[model samples]
Target: MAASVTRVFVSHLAGLPVFDPGGDQVGRVRDLVAMLRVGRRPPRLLGMVVEVLSRRRIFLPMTRVTGIESGQIVTTGVLNVRRFEQRPTERLVLGELLDRRVQLVDSEEGATVLDVSIRRLPARRDWEIDKVFVRRGRGGALRRKGETLTVEWSAVTGFSLEEDSQSAESLVATFERLRPVDVANALHHLSPKRRAEVAAALDDDRLADVLEELPEDDQVEILGKLKEERAADVLEAMDPDDAADLLSELPEEDKERLLALMRPDEAADVRRLLSYEERTAGGLMTTEPIVLRPDATIADALARVRQQDLSPALAAQVYVCRPPEETPTGRYLGTIHFQRLLRDPPFTLVGSMVDSDLPPLAPDTPLRAVTSYLAAYNMVAAPVVDESGSLLGAVTVDDVLDHLLPDDWRETDFEESEHG
Candidate 1:
């Protein structure tokens, strides 16, 4: 092996472009494949899972790789277009190793695996797993600020995951830091039993976020598997619009049961959203956007917008309202864009900077009308009001686009993400 062959971490290698010896682009590296062996020996690199044209995932053996440089991998001229399948002896480094919880063999201290480094053996042309990177902190807090270190692969245990032996707890822990969409994708790839187990392991809020990003079918399936109280809690944790969307998929009886189980206020918001057509302004709106009394100071509005958990779309503006400032109960006044709060003196009342030039969307407005309203006004989110001019909710651009996209857009997005 060339001594100059560079070592790369699996996390960094993920999604890098791959090209053939002829310089023709083949696909992007999706995951690293390795074969588990006896004792503490590092697993040998089998190859990589490359997502090629047509979004088909195929395997490329390390022996066929000619170079790994910059952000791309170069392979020999030959290629196999067959779809990649996991053999019993193989494991995916990114999917199975990175972010997994493992134990320090000597001290029994627990660590969360962060990344794995791989390099070519000095005397052979083959590459194998080199060092395991892990994060550790005192106490049992797996996510607390911790020190990271690279140890030989033999220094750790728990790398071997037999197909039938993988536990849901570890799988959920491995995905704790991943985005909701990524977690949903990983859940989609698991077997039904494993998916249910993983879902059960996640807390209500985390499960709710993942459910929102999943397909309607998946959303219903996972929600259905939970016990009544737990399912209701998860639904309560979800955004009202998303909760309504998922409820719209359930049978009317099941819907009413779950609604009754939820807190009255949360249930009421979802019920109101459910009363509208699936594609209309009311259906696409979230009832939880920031709301402030006209008398609220710029500082107060700023404080609400600064909330760490507030969604960016909803946080972009604060709806100024009459008494009972909360949505669904207040009269529609005007909206105070976040920029106005920043430009005005902190003590200034929001009413003084309210933007009332643009009309609020009627609750029953059609989808096309909402789209046009947002586009024509260049707004990220627009407020919805009842015929009596009471504040209902706000329809965000992201929610509008979600309803407008093709039904299969999620699958298409997964394919496009391979190259991103």
Candidate 2:
């Protein structure tokens, strides 16, 4: 039998020489650009996208592998490395999934990569992979020991591609594992019907996450490609703020159609957020804050983190408080950065960490004022409270910066500044 693919797979590339299929060294193998699994189990290596330079990347099919030695990934190509251009990291969802750590769900089958796909524009050519998700696949391990055969995808010789080129299968094989933005970009490469089918195949939470990351124009375009119900389902799964923002940007007819398609509760949540201007803290935060009583132990707070696994932005910090009391009027309290909690004494009352006795502001707090407040406080984040002073959500420093300095404009003044 031929050598096992696992033995040949290059997981480490400390001194791996990267050559232009021409044998001239262009650069050393900097990193595993992206790993795409072709089939269902043993997560067969369909294609490997590699970084050619700090700014450039190239795709190589696993089939081209001549060999894997002590510190190198040998390739069979003879093409110029300069031919490939660099894709923006924001658009590289495959890169994200390949890097993200995930639970492998130990079994006889090979591990999988889970990722979020995204799109850049309505008429863009391809989708992108934004975040890395490894240990992504899940399947069964044989219950009985004797009859079990743990076969990997590479070990099976019959798996063939349409073309001998490994690059051809890389995109399709990595379908489920691509980033949300990348998914949107890839759909642009497919027929509308096929795009809809892929959209349907995606899980709701994953779809929701991706939808939030996509550009508004791409979000609408992808939504247009989706079947009405599937489109609504994905929207419903998205964070209320993001869904609201997308809905607010959509045309009246499509907005109505999507909202009608969603469940009443979800629709209402989206509607509330839609009513707010996208630049506000309310527009930036998920209303679902993981709140705990001030008296709750660190263990109790951590249990909530495991249970809900809040979104990254929200989970940046967990808010501590008292259970709703008799008055239920002024539960105004402070927030705790997750890192702070980890470093503090385990038994310490979270109430002690409430840094800002300042009441949470209305979501309508002016952008200029928000920036000033955050800067003055040197805070990474601040809770957005309602009239009751109860924590509604948080406003991250980045979110404030996005409002103060949107992507559409350039910072001309900073180009010549020495004032700071």
Candidate 3:
């Protein structure tokens, strides 16, 4: 630690009030974001997520944060109002890293991470995680029987992804509370061998969710390392469109081999998605949208929308078809937005409330046209209908945005001066 540095434990700063230069309260610190480095390097402090007066969480970069002292945080008063979206290179300290199990580098003794300390770098605007407070014990930090010690970050061995199976399990346990995207972000920072080990430890459903968020290369690498049978299971668990996109990156023979191992129904959905152009509506649509029959009531629609597995865009509305409720459903009747379900009586039939004024997208619609349609109609998702007017699936705004952004966008680092 440098002479000018004053180490502050993150636990003490968790709910500290943040103020502008004028001393007006802006928000309270909800969580700190840090960028984990490869190997044993200390993670760099990125910024903190603050809950503002309106309860909207926003990113407050470290550069704009002038001081953290006197049980308060003082900033330059400049903040980005856009909701903070964690990138693949970042980690939420409070939410993910706390209470983790690690080991002492020299003694190789098991230890539990109680807290970590951050200090401003010498003669620079940067900050880094410098110290780790740990308890040497067989159980977690909650047990007071172990010897507590404060050590330099490098003195810890189990924090890195390259640790053994036990350590990997601890890492997985630490990530259990995070969203799939956050878990994928943490994985992106690990070495190939270690990344594969962690991915293997995750269950089929969890691994499928993580694979969807990972870049194509990482997805291919992790999937390649799994047993062929397991890989098929994971593919089956992923959304049909995402699974198809991943399969497209593999060699023709390998793709076919995996597809052959998958369940017939799941493979069929993926195969249909694969038949479309990579950048077309058919290629980007997910076959698992909320689908209902005309006779379904508003209550039924609301209940389907409440599914925990659905993405916000997918849950934003329900597609009403005639006979079959699944994709490639009977003649596409219309769609009912989520708001309509809340407005109408519970007994109202979804068929009578369908909003069919907006034309549905065709399977062959180009990606550019799909983008324009969503923008023009203020829709989060647009239905895809085949030549027979059978509902195929839906293309969501998030998927379109994923395709429209630069290929390396997920790996791009956020600059310190971004807020300044």
- Name the regions of candidate 3 deviating beyond 4 angstroms: 1-166, 413-420
TM-score quality measure for candidate 1: 0.75
| lDDT of candidate model 2 versus the reference | 0.52
lDDT of 1 by residue, 9-51 (tens): 7777766779887788988776789998898999999999887
The TM-scores, one per candidate, come to: 0.75, 0.57, 0.67
Could you arrange the candidates by TM-score from highest to lowest?
1, 3, 2
The CA root-mean-square deviation of candidate 2, after full C-alpha superposition on the true structure, stands at 12.6
Q: Tell me how candidate 3 scores on lDDT.
A: 0.85
Pick the lDDT winner: 3
Ranking by lDDT: 3, 1, 2
Clashing pairs in 3: none
For residues 10-122, write the lDDT of model 2, one tens digit per residue. Answer: 22332256564556654444223333344433222333445443323345544554545445556676433332333432122332222222322333333333333221222
Q: Give the per-residue Cα lDDT of candidate 1 at 66.
A: 83
Quantify all predictions' global Cα lDDT against the true fold.
0.83, 0.52, 0.85
Per-model RMSD to reference:
5.9, 12.6, 8.0
